[model samples]
Target: MLSRKNLEILVAAQKRLYCTFPELPSFEQRWDFETDGVIQALLTRLGDNDPYFHPRYAGHMSGYVCDVAVMSYFLAMQFNPNNHSYDGGRATTKMEVECLDSMARMLDWNHYQGHLTSGGTIGNLEALWIHREMGANTVICSKGAHFTHKRAANILDLKYLEVDVTKDGSLCSIALSGLLAALEATDVPVVVCTLGTTLNGAIDPLDEIFSLKAEHDFKVHVDAAYGGYFYLIRARLAGRNRKAFDFLPAADSIVIDPHKHGLQGFGCGALLLRGVSESTSQAIYTHDSPYTYFDRRGISIGEKTLECSRPGAAAAALWATMQCLPLEEEGEFSRVLLSCHTAAVKMSELLFAVDDVRLIVREPALDIVVFYIECADISAATRQLYEQLKASGFYVAMADCDISSETGVFREVSCIRLTLMKKEHLAMVDELADQIIRLSKCIADEYRSQYQAL
Candidate 1:
């Protein structure tokens, strides 16, 4: 199920794009060998991949690209613009600026300097690199934050520290305050706040974290790669979540991935710096390109980005998608996000009602629901249930969680994680929940039988 309308539009748009350069003499270059059998083999090989486009594939953060974005990307691929410099892709460079502006506006940023990257990992790396250039030695983040933060710190050769997270998998504000209070005299260069965690989709208390900046001299960088688009649906979010979105603009820098919730394909992540001057970026990232930057005297994207040869098609697709969807609270895009969150909430309710299941979080903060099978050996039962579900045509993911017990000790637990990213998932929530409950019981019974036999 792909959209036929998008296919037609892409073909028509590609023809128009070709017609734009009529002045150039056209020459036909044809391949000498026959390619029909090889092409069929390639298609057969690609079909072996998982069905991530289907609504039943709620396993991970992989999302289906919108039809408009797909069409726009295909149309731009006819030109294959490289966004390293204006000379490489003049029209797409302007599109990248407009796309970055739209993202900044969504975060309530008035004045900012930003550009798109290949993905969140590189975007976060650039944010930390900027902090390192500003003479900061320590990088701090929640334990639940993406693992890239620590790796990025290592790459930057800076000291790294992790704050504890609460039972809900969110960074504990009290623990963070304690850590900062102890390091009151130290220079903690960057404090990375994760807006949406990888495992449970937990959002740290950004407002409280930013409040600590009053006493500490650290720059706050928000990793909103997965949850940044949730800002557009603030009207439907819980109070705490809404408050977190409200504090987004206070960050010194932020990373948001257009490929995630922005309904675009992969290789689109953005880094936004608030009130950063051109001189500072020039000092850090500026490099002399002998042949590329000759066309423009002003700052090219190549001078500001950590990467040199980014895809201009990514920018074209994002700009076209934003033009059609628009980042507004009452827009169709916001409603789609709301539906994803609603599906998670509904799934959580269904899990709560089942005696054999236990939710990792009281409720889903975003569109991810995580729960474990209740059994004598929870880890085994959960794994068994995960495999059973997969075998039964329902693809879901698994995560290892740290659970706090009544004795003030932490235990490792394996949990089944479901990300309701597709809008069509809203209709499958009830059936999915019922399937989980039934499979969990079967797994639990099988485990009990084996224990008795032992």
Candidate 2:
């Protein structure tokens, strides 16, 4: 939970910051510091936004950025440092490297290489691009893979193939095995595994696929953009999901979003390479950026990364967040994450007790819980309920693609996917559950005649 204390500290910091600089005569001409008119304008604009920090906002991945990260970002934003090179952001660049080193060590990668990207998409683009640069012919990912995989393949002009997924929305290991066997023995394809599919939060079978990689001679890349941090609590996950994260060390490259589950605001993602070997040196280069590398101590992050002019403030925010919530299994961070998972489990139990709503996945694999009204027309009903829930102060996300059950209980249908990410949600579980249970019954009752005819 947040407090007014953070605001007080920020105010104090702002006062100290002003004392560091001589006030310019033109500073008075700048917008009023705390004008009622300006404050009202901000309130009017930002108040209309979805209550992302609220427990009622079970919607989307736009969860709350913790107080430390938010305060750190605002404080660093004043400096407006660019992380492209040390010439631009010396302190922040060092902070970024240290953060990357800590994350690499968390995944058990000793001699790993990494750099922060603008976000997950570019981070993923670089990972697959590295494999392509290594002369891999094809990039294969599950049908449940993020939409970015195919686009990244297209951007790189590499052959892209998609394997089917299992009933629970996970990548089908059997299908992947067959696909690998059919590929030419000499074909060392780069297989992309999604640790958390955006829609249902399904984890690909990484451990199962690792065995196939050795037998078939393929490189593995993991897109743990949303689920990467969950590796810390693998023991708390369901069997398959836990097993998949257990083999995270085997992946050649990994992309993770600090913004998603790493307790930061938008646009902070990282790419982790196993090691900068002779073969992968093509991807990581540090020759001589005459313009940006003046008096550079070591390799500039811009040299190793595809994107230039990344934000140094992002590094500052994440670094501050890590200080408060160290990436340890038994730390405060993991406890908060576990509480989120518990909210999802508790939500599932509550929905299960409800009369007519059908849960897409029998149980949530992660903090995301997907469920829908069991009506004749799910598309119509789900859209209706999505808006209705929002109006009633219970925001939830709509699925990207249609969901169905294996036994044909629920056909191709739109569903509600709630990202129970905030720890405050644990307290709201019963109220949220009651809200859905009561509304779901109403939605179901309205379509009862149509249901009986079917």
Candidate 3:
């Protein structure tokens, strides 16, 4: 599935970069026979990985990196610039700023400050760190938020609270309001709203959350790590989903992962701050090295970020990809995102037609579709179906959903999860739906036969 043309482009770009630095002496790098053998062995070992790049691999949040991103990353690696300071990566640092500017505009932020990070986890950590510096002692998030938020709160020594989710896996606004009102009596709270949840891709009601913010004195941080880019396609999204992105501009901080939906390779996440001041930016200040920031007069990324020595290749990859697919409404990238949503809706329709399949969410908020098998032992049947689908070359993932009983008890039920992230999935939705039905029937038949034998 890799592109040979992109590889050639990378080679050409590397040569051009080398020619630009003719004043520097060139050194010949020599490798022994053992090095070649080890490299070959490593490639063989990596071959065992599942085919995440193919259309059939709709298992997780992983999406295919575009050719331009791959080529740009490969070309950038030739120099391996560190984006910590301008002294280390003058060109890449500027590229990162421009990339952030594009993303900020995409989110409809008039004025913002942001920097790239290793991934969503660190991006969230840094945002929360800033919240702590603002004197917020407690962090609140929905139960459906990414697990990293709670872990980050613990690491930062702040009080972490999880509000219950509604039946649709959205943050329960009633519960959140009560918590915020109770907490407001004592300490300031920083609410972490998840734009898209991991399990079912459910979106928390950000509009309601913002309304709450008006009543109480609290900061709002949006963890749009998986769903931020959907802002470009908001017009095509379901009404409920579109409302979430509408309130994105009101957030104090936002975390987005370019690696997930930005058509770039891994190790690229961003944290955008709205209406940040010089004092707020100085909350993450660090002592500079004499060797670094000598030439730069303004704010360095290292001074305001939690990480140092971040890869410039990630910046190059994102910059190149954005250049080809600009983040604009009804653009090529937005159309691809809309295609993912359409494909997901198609998958949901197929599951609804099946008698034995029970949808976790009637309609997906984004590209992820989740459903469980209807059987006496639902967990076992769902697990069997997951394994059967993989064996049949239809890869998918699984999650556990809590079902509440009339007696006020909860039970965990295993469910199948499909993330229709690849653009090619738009064309394969029908085939994928057929495969799911056939595989599910086969697994159900096997289960019945085994039950009769028992």
TM-scores of the models, in the order given: 0.95, 0.92, 0.95
Candidate 2 local lDDT, 174-281, one digit each (tens): 999999889875566999999988988889999999988666888899999999999999999999889999999888999999999998888999999985585557
C-alpha lDDT (0 to 100) for residue 190 of candidate 3 = 90
Q: Give the whole-model CA lDDT for all candidates, comma-separated.
A: 0.86, 0.85, 0.85
Candidate 2: worst-modelled 10 consecutive residues by lDDT: 23-32
| Candidate 3 structure quality by residue, lDDT tens digits, 1-454 | 5588767776777778778778889865776556878899999998998888888898888888888888888888878888888778877888899999999898777788899998899999989998888788999999999999999999999999999998789898899999887874668799999988888888899988888877888899999999998888877778977888888888999999999999887889999988668776775564557777776654467767789899888898899899999998978988888999999999999899997677878888989998876655677888888887788788888888885422243467778899998888989998888888987777667767887888
Model 2 lDDT, full chain set: 0.85
Best by lDDT: 1
In model 3, residue pairs whose N, Cα or C atoms come closer than 3 Å (at least 3 residues apart or on different chains), thus clashing, are: none
Give per-candidate clash totals.
0, 0, 0
Give Cα distance to truth, residue 267, candidate 3, Å: 0.9
Clashes of 3: 0
Instruction: List model 1 lDDT by residue over 58-85, tens digit each.
Output: 9889899888888878778768888888
What C-alpha lDDT, on a 0 to 100 scale, does residue 194 get in candidate 3?
A: 91
In candidate 1 the C-alpha lDDT for residue 66 amounts to 87
Q: After superposition, how far is residue 60 of candidate 2 from its true place, in Å?
A: 0.5
